[model samples]
Every structure is written in C-alpha cells, then in structure tokens.
Target: MKDNLVDNNAYTYYHTVWQNGDVAPGTHYLDVTANDKFEGIVKVYVTRRYDADNDHVKAFAIAGANDGSEFEKVADVELPNAVKAGKAEAEFTIAEGKSYSKLRFTVTSTTLERGYWHMAEFQLRPMTLNADCKNATYPEAFAAITKALEEANKAVGSVSVEDIAALQNAYDEYKKAINPETGIDAIGVETLRNNAVYDLQGRRVQNIGKGVYIVDGKKIVR
Candidate 1:
C-alpha cells in the first residue's frame, strides 16, 4: 500500500494500524519534490472509517520552499464537514504566480485515537491557460480536451493510459488547428499534409518526437 501511494496508483491505499504505535498527537510532515519553481494545485486523497469517532484529520497545512530548508506557508486547507466511512478527496489551489520547488504537507492534528494517518494518493498539477482554451482557434476541440483532462485529474482511483492518450489526441488536434506563431486560426496551413511540425513553444521542428508538438496549427505526436 505504501508503494501504491507513491506509484501514482490511487486505487490502493495505506492505513495506520492501532498496534503500530506510530500514531501520536503531533505534527507529521510529507516532503514532495517539485524539481523546480512551479505554481499549481495540490490534491490529497484520504479515507476515514466512521467506525471510530476520532478517525478524521483535524487540521492540514501546506508549505513550500525553494532550497528545501526555509519554508513558507502556502495554504491552510479546511477539513471536511462530515466524516464518512470511505475514502474522499480534497483540492488545495495554490495562488497564481507563486513559485516553489519543494512542497510539504503538515498534518497538524488527527481524530484517530492512535494519531495514525490514512491516505490513498497525492497529486500536484501545474496551472495552465489551456483550461479556458484561450488563444485556441478550435475552441470546440480544445474544450473537449480540457474536459477530458479535468475528468482525469478528478479521478479517485487508478487511471488508465488509454484515457490519458485520448485526452492527448484531442489536445494535439486543437494545437494543430491553432497556429502557434499567430495564436490564431490555421486556415492557410495544411497541417495533416505538412510533415513539418513545431513544439508547444512555437519552435519549428523536423520531427514530431515523443512530447507534445504543433503541426500546422494542430498538436500531434510522432
């Protein structure tokens, strides 16, 4: 279950046993590596069995740091109103334009008698303007892709590769239709017939490559 939490497989979960003696009424920390400064939303998936009245977490706080030593509080998330027997998820949106390389989750208090923690997954997604399909020539296609991505992001359990691939395909189509150079329509360019492609940043490329790329005005993969 510990492996599952870190493996991005949300279907599995980790729990605290009463006998572990690890549960205590003190602050617990989780360190997350973001690699570089970034601004995004953080999501935590946790479960509480109402079998015990003290099964829920009481307070949660998130902090961030650039050097991983000095940290500043980024958010203080509100606890859920009602505690259920099954797993539930919550999202904490980071302020726009704020950058941090390291993130930490500090669980200040818990309801469990032993102070044990139970969690299924944790995720951080970077903020993107694509959610609004701004500057998109093919709004419909872009909107579809955005919807798919949102659904994938909100998924609670294991997410299939096929689901992600389909979303990527939709995004590629929209990228192909919107000329990156102009940020406008792709009327003059015949992307399907043109072999030349460009990366998401508008740099012309000879190959589609593995990452997302723009052909004509549409986004495609090699």
Candidate 2:
C-alpha cells in the first residue's frame, strides 16, 4: 500500500513480473475501494509496461460491486501490446452507469510465454451528470443554468459567481409565480351550458381552440 499503483505518480508499477521464460503465465487482479458510492467510471488509463523483456497483460476486464460482493463485469478491452517502448501511456474508456463502491480490474497475461503484468499508473475517474430539464415545468429557469454552464466551460479560468447567482435568482422568482397549487385542469368539450359553452375569457366559444374554460362549476378543455 505504500507504493500504490493507482497513486497517479507513475514512479512505480504493480511489479508482478518476477518470473522468467520458464515460469508459468499469470492473471493479475487489482481493485480500488471508494469511500462513497459512484455511479460509473470514465477515462480508464494505464501506463504501458516500460521494458520489452517482461511478459505483460494484453487485455483487461473491469468489474464492480456495491456491497463488496457479487461483482458484475462492466467493461473489458484488449490492448495493442503488453509492453511498448515508444510511449508510457495507454487510454481506454468505460461507460457503465451502475452504482458501486468497489472497482476491480482483471488483467490476463499474454499467451505462449512467461506470465507477468506491469503498468505505471492505473487511473479511473467518476463523474456526476447534470439533471435533465427538457420536460420540466419551468424550463426557462433550467435553461438559464445551462447557459451559465456553457459560459463557464468556455472560459476555464474566469468563473463569474454573479452570473450563477443571477440565474438562481431568476429560477427562484419563477418558482414564486407558479405557486398556490389549485390542482384543477380544464378538459372536455369547448363549452357545456346546455348546448352553450363559454371560455375562461367569458366569451361565447363554439370551436375547439385548446383553451381552458368553465363548464358546470368546473374547468374543461376541448
């Protein structure tokens, strides 16, 4: 635990490559525990093995468990090579949206050779997504928050708290206007006053205009 492979420092690897050409292959398993529950992980990255002599892992599978039991396979990938000399970085992505507190990776060594696995820093990232507002009752309020997010993303260093507060204030003001829940909706024909009907505007209506109207002490829509 002192030299954690997932520390992101990349100074050392898991260092399982202890066997020679006469040794058997290895299947390495690595796991990370989190203090909080995460929905999913993105950006799966591992530093490729440095030397050419070590038998490395060519493919890996990821699994997750919520209660530290019954792990479910979330994703897997076959690497281009177990070890490379050119670069120390390899990239992969996992898009599983299931909740978990423990994430584990299963790395299998390349076949027909000595078994071992080595990699620099193993990195994974979890993300929180914005709430959906497409079908919200007051969409404009959420739209303002989306606009603020767009502006913040465009200018990374300069974030305006005043802009965010303004958007929040707008949403709060809109909330006040839609209060006093009268839980009544208009439905049915245009008007029903014994063959005569009237709209909310107290006007004589005969056609279906899709407007709220009063009929028999109740609201109705045609």
Which residue pairs collide in model 2, if any? 25-115, 186-221, 187-220, 187-221
Query: Over the stretch 19-52, how does candidate 1's per-residue lDDT look in tens digits?
Result: 5556664445676777556566656655554344
| Alpha carbon lDDT of each predicted model | 0.56, 0.50
- lDDT per residue for candidate 2 within 77-182, as digits (tens), equals 6655533421233344445556778877776545444445566556554434324422155556445644544453344345456644554465345445434242
Deviation of model 1 at 69, angstroms: 3.8
Residue runs of model 1 more than 4 Å from their true location after superposition: 8-11, 15-22, 40-58, 79-87, 93-97, 111-116, 128-143, 149-222
How many clashing pairs per prediction, in order? 11, 4
Task: Report the poorest 10 consecutive residues by lDDT, candidate 1.
Answer: 184-193
lDDT of 1: 0.56
Stretches > 4 Å off in candidate 2: 1-11, 21-26, 82-97, 109-115, 127-222
- Residue 100, model 1, lDDT: 77
